[model samples]
Target: MEAPVSADKLRFLIYRFKERLWVKPLTFCLLSIAAVFFAKIIDGTPLAEHLPIIEQSSVETLLSIMASSMLVIATFSTGTMVNAYTSASNSSTPRSVSLIIADDVSQNALSTFVGAFIFSVVAITSLKNAFYGDAGVFMLFVLTCTVFAIVILTFIRWVDSIARLGRVGSTIQKVEDAAMKAIDHRLNNPRLGGFVQPNLTALKEQGAEPVYCEQTGYVQLVDMTKAQNWCEHHNACLHILVLPGDFVSPNNPVALIERTATNPTSNKASFESTEAAACEANDIIKVGHERSFEGDPRFGLIVLGEIAARALSPSVNDPGTAISIIGSYVRLFLCWAKKDEIRDKPTDEIVQFTRVSAPELNTKDMFNDAFSPIARDGANIIEVAIRMQKALQVIAKCENKDIQKYAQEQASIAYKKSMNTFQFEEDKGRLDETKWSD
Candidate 1:
């Protein structure tokens, strides 16, 4: 089924918002202020007489303690997060920093501390100003106690997570999880909910006009539903030329718009309509300065390869990390290969967007994006080479013929590279003997 354009936009917006460090803190701060004032609503209620009398001094002392302690904790937690981010960037690829920064537990812990501080300050100020009656004070006390309980729980959980937040293994795991998500989505919607792109030469020969964008950046998303709607209304078909992670500029066409029929001698009104539709086609595709993982499965694989390359560099001779990354590649490919098992038969005729054409992520491209760099960088390391060969052999056994072919091809390439670089004859012989069995 075709996903709505608004849904993609919304999900992307939410993802972008999550990457910002201040968003959660700001939201919590606002909610804290609201909570403090909400007690004022119960000031004149008849239940005030039944509510227990809470001493003002006790509340004042508790608020003071909370205000002071929370400020210190929030500042400390922020510094710790910054250090963890730096460690992740240094140990792994810098791209992994965003994943750590977007950690929900860390963000929630910081937000809670900040919110508690704000709540205490506001409550203290309101108490001094005599803003609350007996019942209101009691309600404020209850909220304050609940806030303390929450802070304690979040602190404990955050401490446990922060311990491994920036370690190399933790960073690699995060990247793998992200890659798994992207590959799964790609497998489920191979054509991104559109029909396979027809022949570009044929499309061009049929007078399909290219749609160019004014901005230069990577193509982050293509709104197929919008393109389908525009095509249906304008009596045209759209062929998307670029997928997510593809860099584009004004000189490069993002898609080709082909008209079903032409009226060369159309009136001025029709000409203006055609011009308007051409402009709308440009809006259907989204371009951004950076590649996003949401729409690009290959981006994750590329990042994982980068991490392994950095590990294999002379400064960081961590062959173990690189070998672990090889395992990750196999796991990701296995997840992708499960698509063949999911479908009982071929789905060549299953298409949701008849008017839109988009390309699918090719298996060769996936293997090249992920394994090529690792193979080139770690070719001489016997341990890394052996692991890569074994990983590929395991992948070659999967049911998907395309995956098997690519796996074998990558294995052969890695083997040749290792053979040329190995210092000893024994190492080469050992690698040669590690081939996939029949």
Candidate 2:
């Protein structure tokens, strides 16, 4: 049992915060303000004497120019980003807009522009108010020049990146990357640091108490660490009923808790303990309005599937994009199969949370999420169907039994769909040639 999420809780929170459009820019703005004042510390230092004298007027003029130019650039960049976001939402699935918005280049470029503008304004104000002596002005001058070089380099890089930021190819790649990352994490921590859950019905029959969620939403992050702690505290075993990306309501139970046979508590005390522990167990599960990329590998696959469906829509009718998505699906599943092989081999896969039991992600469900929509939508297009079958053919060759099984299943579905939809015998015959082998 790898306690990845225990450390990841903080990392996950930080990742969520970084996803917001304002966070990086706000950070840069504060740093910019601090930089202006920081240079002031050099004013009375002996090192100030070694610093070449820079005229206050020259520095002031440069700051004024930078301030005005950066403001305009920032405004223009913002509008462009908005347009890119709109383009992404329209061309790709709207779910992918979050990934585009969280793009490092775009965010860094925008943050630099905003931060530079603030830096200029602050520096100019300080200069006008005589806040810097000769030494400070010299140091500020060097800082100003450095800012200029960074802004120019960023602007150039940003222009190149903005050109393709929301384009279909770029957006598809982003989605694929996100999906791969999520899939890799899940493969590494198969049961999310818990033992395989034996049987839910059997456990419940043995007097396990189901812990119901207070609200209705998708399960975003299941802090397995917290669940482990709860189990340790009560000397009980916890069975996680819901995996990340599972929809839950007050009617649905998030987990089940059963007292261990070794526990010394009597029946009366155990019942009371269950009642008191229910709320604590519930808090370990974090629910949200929409599905998140973290903790939910299926969400990424679902998003990719949605994109392929959108491309196959009559309005878009982009079979090429659909084919590309199928290729991405192949890469993701192949990577998954490779990781599955590694996980199966005996290694230091430590079981830290002995009291926690979590369900493994179903390969069938993952295949359904990744391929079903594309199979349905692309049934009529021989190119997409051929490519999809071929992709499945490759995946079905993997040694991992689950991967091979599901890939074959999806291939069968896609083949049947093509048989029904193809108007020409030649098209059907072409797809048949790419069918998965035993």
Candidate 3:
């Protein structure tokens, strides 16, 4: 499917681009090459003559140290990151690896480290060839000092970031950031900036024909532009039944189409054109079992659930992690609940003119997606249950009646679940009543 347009689309593209492990490193490498040449230009300038003096031997030694140490640092950083990813997958959830891998600080720190190494090697080569005079040599020494300082600072920060990179708390934070961004967008554009049409029953009564999915998997993205274009070209109205994060089955109806034919020949052409449009719409709707970072914010919620599930597993038995995940679930829900803007105004006339319809994502459905697994597995864990109850109670304060009711119901279920699991009244009593405190 063509990817969702506007803010969500741009955010998705930028995220994927920046998440690349090599992007910053490669960019730094190029900049290092530029800096080297830049230093050459500044070497013989009048400004270079007044630059602080430094010995040839000192620079040579510094270059050698940087060259050797950076290579080791590169290897070490790679190994550390690999280990972090492994640990996250084992202790937390594998789905979170993608978010952690995209950590901006970690990527930039690694990039600076690698870039410094390259700069040193090139600087050393320049020195060996006697490429600089006293001024150039002096400038190179200053640049090297700056590089050293950067290496030290970057190393310090990288150490701190890597320590928690794939840990449960960090993973939850990443998922929450992602989900909240999506939810906020959804809150503003409930129908995703498209038309607010009737349900499947209403559309079916209007003689709308169903468009079956070509493949079975999670609907990652829908190309609104392409789908709308297909409808416009065929003079049809397409009503979407599925959205991103929806699991589709092969030959299942994903959208229902209504043909608008005014001419008698157009009536016959309408059926044929509707079939063609359905095929094109299916092509426009990209589906796969693996959820993508683009289009859907719910994927992040699902991942947050994964973390809770893993934390509750017998091997991990980490209630704190589950609590953290539940907290993130609440944060995301609040963001979704309070959201009021679509985040991006439609850029094209077609989007505003088309009768294409997209459904609003329900908070209750996402609530279940993020918390049900933990509720199922960690019901017996007092801390997890209490935290979940409090989290829901906090959300209930939002004053949205339906959400409050849902929160109370989930809290009730949690209490009942704990009661069933606990043999002692003391354990059950601990959860029977939860104080509503921030």
Candidate 4:
């Protein structure tokens, strides 16, 4: 949406002129000057006998030559300006109908026409003396040329503008089409299947195992024989989970698993102890609730799997982090509702989650520190961040209270976590300061 750069404007101007600036202007100027001097060449010679005709006509001829010179100058200037304007407009990629309409091709055309008309008038004036001082005819010639030039320029300008507009429109349509295709590709890709891919290679390298299921919900029991068979074929361990029908709370065991020991003899005792410890941990946090949903228990399993993914990789690169954050926030609200004995209450019975009056952080200091490196890299990151922050603030004020509250809470948590992690990494010399810049 921003205007084209100065360099582009200059380049456009130069390109439009091409070789015409020097060739046309120099040729016209020299011819005009020679015509003026030609009057002297005829003076006091055998041509003096014809001096009356030449002298009488010389003034008009001189005027005509001068006009020609002026026309050349004007035409060159107009061409350069038009080229610059056209190039600049093309680069901007206007999005609005109003902006598209405002692209002033008419102005450029008018300038070009005026320049060409001036040149035509100058050239015609030089020949006026030969017309035996017929002023009306000379005036007519000049007027006709001017009108013709104007008409031609106007037509050219309109055609160019329309063509440019069409090109821009076509480009935008193509981009939109490509974006839609990309969305479709992502949605339909079999490998992804609307589910996050487990990093099986990483898990294997780390000596951890992943479990997969097609049906919804957690497994209540694993047929050991079947599990072992599957594991042997896939070179993986079997993961088991208890279903919700089983009476289990956050304080009860939800699942048990057997892992291949790293050492057969010396680690057998340690491996048993480790497995027992893991089972105890799972028992402590198992959800204790009746299965309210009729079908697809895999939904709950997927949710739990996603949560585990987030626990493993708590960063922006991890897709699970955003989901986990939102889910956790929702869970927190649910816990609050339960504590207030409003868990079964209708929507109207719930208190409106209004936005809290909170103090704004002093962003000036943060911007100063954050953007210093950006500035060094020849950018205005602070300016951009400040603009974005201001826009967000305005949006928050206008948004629904619940939405605003959720956004604010999420932002605060993300920022805090990011700062804490950054500090920890920096202290541990794990962060490269050079990489952080820009």
Q: Count clashes in each candidate, considering only residues at least 3 apart in sequence or on different chains.
A: 0, 2, 5, 10
On residues 360-434, what C-alpha lDDT tens digit does candidate 4 reach at each position?
A: 112232222222221222111222222223322333343244434543443333333333444344432321221
Candidate 4 has a TM-score of 0.21
Off by over 4 Å in 2: 1-5, 262-273, 345-350
On the 0 to 100 scale, the lDDT of residue 248 in model 1 is: 93
Segments of candidate 3 deviating more than 4 angstroms: 1-6, 43-58, 130-139, 205-209, 225-236, 260-276, 293-295, 339-354, 434-438
lDDT of 3 at 356: 82
Q: Give the TM-score comparing model 2 with the true structure, all chains together.
A: 0.95
In candidate 1, stretches whose alpha carbon ends up further than 4 angstroms from where it belongs are 1-5, 261-275, 341-350
Best by the TM-score measure: 2
TM-score for each candidate, following the candidate numbering: 0.94, 0.95, 0.83, 0.21
* C-alpha-based local distance difference test score of model 1: 0.87
Ten-residue region with minimum lDDT total, candidate 1: 266-275
Model 1, span 166-273: residue lDDT tens? 999999999999889878877776677778778999888977888888789988888877887777767678898888888999998888888776556642222245
Error of 4 at 338 (Å): 42
- Ranking of all candidate structures by their lDDT, best first: 2, 1, 3, 4
By TM-score, rank the candidates, best first: 2, 1, 3, 4
Write the residue-wise lDDT of candidate 3 on 1-438 in tens digits: 233464555665677777689988999999887777677787657787677777989999998999999989988998998888898888777777877788888888889989999999999998999888777887788889999999999999999898898777877788788777777656655666567667779768878888899788888766666667666666777788888888899667988887776565552334456566677778867787777655577788888888888878898778887887787877777776564323244445214536588776776787678778887898888888888888989888885666777777777777777778988787777786683333
**What's the lDDT for all of these models?**
0.87, 0.87, 0.77, 0.34
- Show the lowest summed lDDT stretch of 10 residues, model 2: 263-272
Q: Which tens-of-lDDT digit does each residue in 297-415 have in candidate 2?
A: 88888988998899899998888988888888889988888766756755447355688888878889999999999989999998898888889989888899888888889999999
